[model samples]
Target: MLGRVLGGISTSLFFATFECWMVAEHRRCGFGEELLRYMFGLMFSVQYLAAIGAGLVAQAAASVVPLTRLSASSSWHYGGYTAPFDISLACLLLAIPAIQMSWTENYGNNKAGAAGTGIAASLRAGARAMGSSWQVPILGLAVATFEGSMYCFVFNWTPALDAGGGLPPPHGLIFSSFMMACMCGSSFFGMLDSSYRPVKVLLPVILTAAAALGLTALSLARGSTSNGAVFAGFLIFEACVGAYFPCVGTVKSEVVPEEARAGVYNVYRVPLNAFVIFLLLTDISPATQFGACCCLLSVAAGAVWLLGRVEQTR
Candidate 1:
């Protein structure tokens, strides 16, 4: 219990600190940032795609024939559990020089101003500024809910498949396929014309995602759908997940005032982190949780559609 609590806090703090700053830095790029941002998104997708694909192959091969360069005993081996981390640490060490060479002056310091005296005061002021516009909070809520659902899927999809769909362990095939689909999704969205507004594009994507989630939930609950069908449904949903980062970033740049962007972004994380933790703690069946996600996605779709209509007026 204590470990879970600490893990959640540590995860939340790391994301709130690092992720928010990353977004802020992207925003500071000024012109053509959307293209750059989504390009970065595409790079991220490719990175994961390759990593997941490699991991799938390695794990599958290890399952068939365990590799043991260093072994405590016959049953204990290095390949499956320990070798990956060693490789990762080695890669991290190798990248340090490149990372140092690429480092730039902190862009966040430029955004920081005397909005208030301290962190608390700055948060209060940012909140007040955001509250002055209803759209800010509404958009924040919608994005948070949407992002939270994606995170839930990230954490639970494998277990859900194993327990409810009769899928077994070592889900490399499914994971890699999803990552590949995500890569295609991100690339497609990144290439779309800039004439289209972010909110307008998101409305339909959100609706499609909700429909996919609903189908997936039904498949999980009834077991009428084949594994292929379940996988297809999730692939479609993963495409939407890929587009979501760029779309929400576009909306944030448009709707959020410049001064409060960082604070409001962190504020949005509150509901997202909260929802994820709630779902994590729950003992409900996977099908039931997926059904709940369908409902939540439906609401989020409606909210984003309304937000789009309002954005048209502005």
Candidate 2:
């Protein structure tokens, strides 16, 4: 339980704090928005590549250990002493020096006090900031709806592949493939963002994602065993996932004030977590759940379109 709590805290720090720091630094340096978009693309592309490499290293470490939980879990040595957590620790240790030596510590200008406000205070401010503009809440709507669908993809992808009677899917290999597809999407973002605004780009991205998931859900609902079609659809969805991170970041960076950036950014995860937790508590069919995601994406597309209109007027 303590480990999970720590992990949750770490996840928040990773997604919120690191991004807040980078964007603050970028603005401090006075770079162009074009450059910021480029950095987002390059950063995520490299991060995906690192994920692939880390997965490979972890698999190598895991396979070295004796299999103990084979009957109960497809993952044998995971979370064991010989698992990737050791490598994760080592990597974190290595990162400490690089960060301490090279990176400057950045903080949000919390007007509440120099000592800073607590989580609840930050969230309250974030919520208030959301109310201040049409774009903020609309951006939040886009994030919540799209990411609500995305978390479903994260949990369902492996089972969707494994349902066909066959050898268990190579989990690591499949993950690496997904990351590569995301890298492709990231590269695509770099190319497109150079020409089009991120808001404009998100319209087709959300639509393509919706279509991909819709097709896959249709197949699953029909009791079809065509894994090829499902895999193709999933890859398409992941590419959209790659495009979304930088695009969403760029959009939010434009709309959300820096003072409330991390707070509001973290607040966007509220609905996503709630959606995922509700799904976890329910016994809904995967096809039904995934189809629900398609519907939500349609809603997100509408939101994005309206946001585009709003952006045009502004």
Candidate 3:
């Protein structure tokens, strides 16, 4: 249904092809998961470069056109085909040769015919994998809890700030700064040892996360705190979050079974989605919600330590 709405039959076909290729890539990259995960972090950092460019374009567009008028319309191209769309088309065209020239390696040389089990069997296998390792779901939930809190802020920060002492309305500048921090964090964490043992690295990252969330709770608690202080706390939190992606990705790669990686990851999102929904449905203040996030991060740090112990024992 969504595919039909997006680009009719063409989008559906594109997605079908995309997923098939992606699963192949996933299998090839499964063994060196940490390195693959680190590469993804670097890729994300590159994506943020695109984001910065987009923001600049948007800002420039705003300067020439009144935001009020721009916001009133859904179409940015009343003048017919837009330059952005043209550039997108050209990029897609160029990517064909780029992809062909890209590095290709697969650690596992299993026959392509043995790529997957039957759907029913695969589903059953995935279910079994969920219970096969406590480390998988436990670490997954812990990471999700921490990330879900960050996403809550991403979606609600503007209103959350507005509610607390009439802090200034949200602007693009704050979001751009947060993305910059995230990029830096990803780059920094990517340089860490790409070992399967993530406990040593994750321990400090999670602890820092807890401390940052604690500060956020504190900043929000004091209604009299200057908005600058609150904003700074948020920035610090974002900076810590930079390392979170590669760290958690490494942990997930360490524990998640190769056959069930996709299914297990989807299961991991259940708790995260539920957590965010609960927060959004309630009328709780940002401080209260942030305090809750702090507790979750604290629990996650402990769980991560225990997970490390389990890994070492094995």
Residue 57 in candidate 2 has what lDDT?
74
Q: TM-score ranking from best to worst?
A: 2, 1, 3
* Top candidate when judged by TM-score against the true structure: 2
lDDT of 2 by residue, 106-152 (tens): 65454446356678877987998989999998888889899989988
The superposed Cα distance between candidate 3 and the true structure at residue 2, in angstroms, equals 8.3
Q: List the residue pairs that clash in candidate 1.
A: none
lDDT of candidates 1 onward, in order: 0.70, 0.84, 0.65
Best by lDDT: 2
- Give the higher-TM-score candidate: 1 or 3: 1
Model 2 per-residue lDDT at 112: 44
Candidate closer to the true structure by lDDT (higher is better), 1 or 2: 2
Q: Give the TM-score of each candidate.
A: 0.79, 0.90, 0.73
In TM-score terms, candidate 2 sits at: 0.90
lDDT score, candidate 2: 0.84
